[model samples]
Target: MDLSDTQHRLLAYLREHIARHGYPPSQMEIARAFGFRQNRSARHHLEVLAQAGLIELATGRARGIRLTGPGTAGTPGDGLLQVPLLGRVAAGQPIGSDPEVRRELTLDPSLFRLRPDYLLEVEGDSMILDAILPGDLIGVHRTPQARHGQTVVARIEGELTVKRLDTGGAEGNGGHLRLLPRNPAYAPIEIDARIVDFAIEGLFAGLVRPG
Candidate 1:
């Protein structure tokens, strides 16, 4: 639906607030965010948003703003999906697992063409040639298996790594698993699943880059 610039910002902020904090912002919070002197100013904008059918507000609740239409909850809509942004996953070396929820990111479902289960923040340049760089948030779909040539989130000996999967060649390092890097500067990691704890955590879906 068509919306004024202020309405658009309000909706976007509402979505982000809900995604990050698990609830809508109060009128006071909106007023403070938009530099309005009174909470009523924020309420006025919300009323306009509701009239435009962009949100549904509960009459008596403090945090009642609910986004409606194409990019929010309710029904089988092609709206935004909340994906947990996880801690850094190494592209250079195996990193200790600390999969904390940094925040929730609201992204359009069609952006990935797959329902991503989470987001892993890149910490190194191992996959830079593939456009996956440090500080990039990669959307991943949780899976135990990945096909050859696909980028995957894999755990080797309890450490997480992101790399391109190569399953076509004969077993290297006495195993059938390998984590290949896209950059020419980095070497491939041959995994001996027999000796190490190995598993495919997820498949690469898409990326969210810094602005």
Candidate 2:
């Protein structure tokens, strides 16, 4: 379809939302995201998309939108990646990692700067300053090592947490390693490998915000 720039953006957002959340965004959510004064504006855009055969909408449903055009089925041939949603991890203090696979999210590779091996639901606001907020689904690239200043998914004493890696500490000399938080309200986590088990599970790839 010959979509306008705003229509194209709205379509992309709809695809991303459905891929990330397993459902389309509500009209109110769309209105807020697009800065529309009323939900009617969002509805108008959706109706245009629906008329173009890009999406199918159901009446009497809060999140009734569905993708229907070419490359919208989220298949491998459509250039979509199926990344597993592997439970929750803490963005505040270290929390027990839930290794269970909740569901698979079909996402566009362009959403992340780096390709992610899996997705994790964050559960704290410690990384808010870094734009990783509570309930955000963060993309994690599986890796045993990460460079300094890079955000990493680390395990300390079997619990997982997301933080910026600071190897500048005595860690280079086999001492304590630091997991720095973006928010100053929370203190950085110091890992004493001699006392607690510490390992870098993966590097932070990118994230998909909840709609």
Candidate 3:
């Protein structure tokens, strides 16, 4: 139960995947989820988790990973809800309505300023200045609208990405709204509603960092 941060995440992901889809992710899927280039990386992690009593891997089966029911910690309570952990939101499109739920996170709604509809495992450092890191979990409140300057999950063209909402271009830039990144290392993304598909997926509600 004394899991490393990565191991803890793996366990959480295993539980979440099963909860959402009634199946655990394959080793390859886990590797891909965590950005590991090789299946061996995930295999090693799974072995570690198994030895720790967090999961049981059935031999000879493809998707045989099973949760052993709260090993390192006690059972979760009613105060927690399993929030879907979404995969990468590409910059060119909105995420599909049935986009795969990579995992589920058990969280308390009261921990955040607003209740979150889901949790997104961010993949890039575009929002580093805002303390949103590559592996950090950002809680999202499902909504189609956001106030100017608020952080939001949006889809442009067909891809999805997170950025600060900027609705100030009613006259200039051909009324093209912009998705601004907090870090100066990245430039703002301009969205011309006339030329590309665009929609707001959610508003930033809270954040959970990996420990």
Give per-candidate clash totals: 0, 0, 8
- In model 3, the Cα lDDT at residue 19 comes to 51
Tens digit of lDDT per residue, candidate 3, span 1-211? 5778999898888766655443467888899999999998998999998898767777765666766655422234433445777666532223443368876655544446778888776777788787777777778899887778899898766667888889874553246798888788788887886677788888888777655
Model 2 lDDT per residue over 1-211, tens place: 6778889999999877777664467899999999999999999999999999988877886766777777684545445566788999998889998999986665666667788999999998999999999988899999887778999999988999999988875544266778999998999887776678888899998898766
Query: Could you tell which candidate, 2 or 3, scores higher by TM-score?
Result: 2
lDDT-superior candidate, 1 or 2: 2
The root-mean-square deviation over C-alpha atoms between each candidate and the true structure, in angstroms, is 5.5, 6.9, 9.3
Which candidate would rank higher by lDDT, 1 or 3?
Answer: 1
lDDT of 2: 0.84
Top candidate on lDDT is 2
The C-alpha TM-scores of every prediction are 0.72, 0.67, 0.58
CA displacement after TM-score superposition, residue 2 of candidate 1 (Å) = 12
Which residue runs does candidate 1 get wrong by more than 4 Å?
1-44, 56-67, 70-76, 170-174
